[model samples]
Target: MDWDKLRIFHAVADAGSLTHAGDTLNLSQSAVSRQIRGLEESLNATLFHRHARGLILTEQGELLFDATRSMAQRLDAAEARIRDSKEEVFGELRVTTTTGFGSLWLAPRLNKLYEKFPDLRIDLMLEERVLDLPMREADVAIRLKEPSQADLIRKRLMGVNMRLYASKDYLDARGRPEKIEDLSHHRLICQNVNSTQVSAGSTYTQELLTYNIPSLLTVNNYFGVLQATLNGLGIGVLPDYILADFPDIERVLPPSESREIPVFLAYPEELRHSKRIAAFRDFVTEEIFEHRKNLHESGDT
Candidate 1:
């Protein structure tokens, strides 16, 4: 088995498309196809069941892929160890977090991290679905709740509460709600009760829904809800961390809030010594400290 051919085959199989694999490998489609053919001939087996959509691995290909996948993971582990031996934080760091925090909080503050580690590349994956950290789906994760995944080194970064907020202009026009019952006459914006989110947030949203709000705007993510609130659409339920970025948004019915949701930073236990992880973890920790300090000094706490 030729290592180069196997590598190309692995890329093609992983992507499920020749063009995508070619793009990643920096090779032409013809070249990738030729390598796959050569690999098939060398092994005397039809590796892929080709169709109009894409290729599917055959029984033999599945067996070969299992071996190649193990080889690739081992290689990645060896590379991570090699990189950890160096002090420089220069490599791709895949970080995952909720769309709300990643977009509204972490992404804006990443420039400071970049300023320190000028050569670092961050791949920010914003989604609600938890990635498999132990499987290398993401290098690090900042989540609204403590990760339940085992074999992870997790730190509780902070706690955030979901609260009602609206644009100052909107509140000035509609008048602020003095109590939860008063909210029935105003437009309430929040994540859909069915959306994948922290249980605390979802529970709070469900409770608000029972108030018979005159108008409702439900978004799947807080980012959308925030945008709508900023537009003066309605009072939105959002995390407290956003106050640092959106000063114009005023908290409404200050006493109305969800149970505090803990923010956590976690990484695979195997990456305990990784310099990249350490750099990212330290940078995020510093940002949170600064955020807290700013809120205190501004009298916004």
Candidate 2:
């Protein structure tokens, strides 16, 4: 099996169209098609079924896709490591982060880094879904939770405190809840479509029973919760940094029972010693640690 042909096949599978994949790789459509045909011939299996819409992967293709993706990622990482050894920070820094944090915090800070090192290209991937960093999907990942994988290095950058907050108008109309039991009477905004446990053997659904609040609005994204809270829809439990500038919003409950989401900087264990990765990791750690108190206080607004 030729690795180049496999790489082209993976690209086509990922892009879902020969034309799209060809554009991505700067190859002509004919060249990409030939490569895919070569790969299929080499493997003695039909990888994709052609359709007017796009190419659909066959059962054999699906299996090969999974294995080849991992292999391709490792190969790319190895090349990156080799290039880094030459003392040039000229490679791309593929970073994955949650939409909210990437937009509100990290994006702004990255400007200074870029200004300092113009050769260091940054591909900022903003998504709610966590990317598989071990497979080389990203060079660095800013995760809300600690990485449990044994081969990854996890650094706790800071703790994000979630507080219950509501607009002054909503509180004035509905009245403030004095105890956890009183929350049952008030309207609440619930985030997380499928509630997962933050810790081992723990379930968020089970934890929700403790609050026992009747949800007025359910949103999948944290930004949705913030918008709803701002509109005086209901009280929302959100990270403090998100609400820092909103003067109308007030923290309804003290820090009791507040969930602390630990922010972690995760990367492959092997890339820890790389100068570029080390520099970025240290810079982010120092900045966040210095502003930890401010991040907590910002939510009270």
Candidate 3:
């Protein structure tokens, strides 16, 4: 159980080549190979299968690699905690959220955050998958629902609903649907009913389909739906929050909308004291507050 040898083994397993691992670790190829050999000898395990193409991890190597990956994430978390300054917020903060909210909402407002903490480096991971925050897959998450994961500090950010919208041109050309039943004459753009999304959205889409809409465009994510709607393709089912930034898109069938989807901001309890987390949390909270204020002022709420 030599830490140095294990480190070298992890690198080699990761790169699948002695020379590549050596370049990364600043060791000669022979040195790297020697370390791997010694590690295998000490453990009495064949860690990798060597071939002309490259090295592939054996069963033992796969187990060790999984352990090392966890170790690396834990080490990264520790390093971030140690680097946090009392008064300064810098270094990397990894944030994960749904692609729609990240790209359509948070990403656009990040310039204000940079203006205040220019030294801060943010890695925005946008996808539908919920990353393991406690294991440091990401430092923070803004989820569409309250996170079911334990040992995390969660805050309800806001509530969102899937509502109908269309570009002004589309409405002017095709006309707006005054009632839900009138949707039968219009093209409906929305997230696919089978896509991985909040139940509320899929349910809303299902209800819309009951009207026997003749034309439909279904995307997996709201961004795609937003894009098609913006281009005047059809009336799109989208999150109401999008209205704060995309005010030009007119809301259609105002009485028809989805159930509330609660937005939550969550982080590991361990990160509760991290200054970077505090700064990011505050920035997002403030942004949402401002967004709500604007919506109310414009009577869109």
- Which model, 1 or 3, shows the larger TM-score? 3
What does candidate 3's lDDT look like per residue over 1-301, in tens digits?
Answer: 9999989998999899999999999999999999999999999999999999999999999999999988888898888878874679998899999999999999999999999999999999999998999889999999999999999999999999999999999899998788888999989999889999999999999998999999999898999999999999989999999997886698998868899999999999988889999999999999999999998998878
- Model 1 residue 217 CA deviation (Å) reads 0.6
* Model 3 TM: 0.97
* True-structure lDDT of candidate 1: 0.92
Root mean square deviation (Cα) for candidate 2:
4.0
Write the residue-wise lDDT of candidate 2 on 1-301 in tens digits: 7878888889999999999999999999999999998888888899999999999999999999998888877889888888778776677889898776777578878877877677988899988777888778888999888877668988888766656789999999999877767878877775653643233112332354466766667766566777899899977766666554467888876753345678899999888777778768977976675466555556432
lDDT values, one for every candidate: 0.92, 0.77, 0.93
TM-score of each: 0.91, 0.76, 0.97
Residue 258 of model 2 has an lDDT of 42
The total of clashing pairs for model 2 equals: 0
Ranking by lDDT: 3, 1, 2
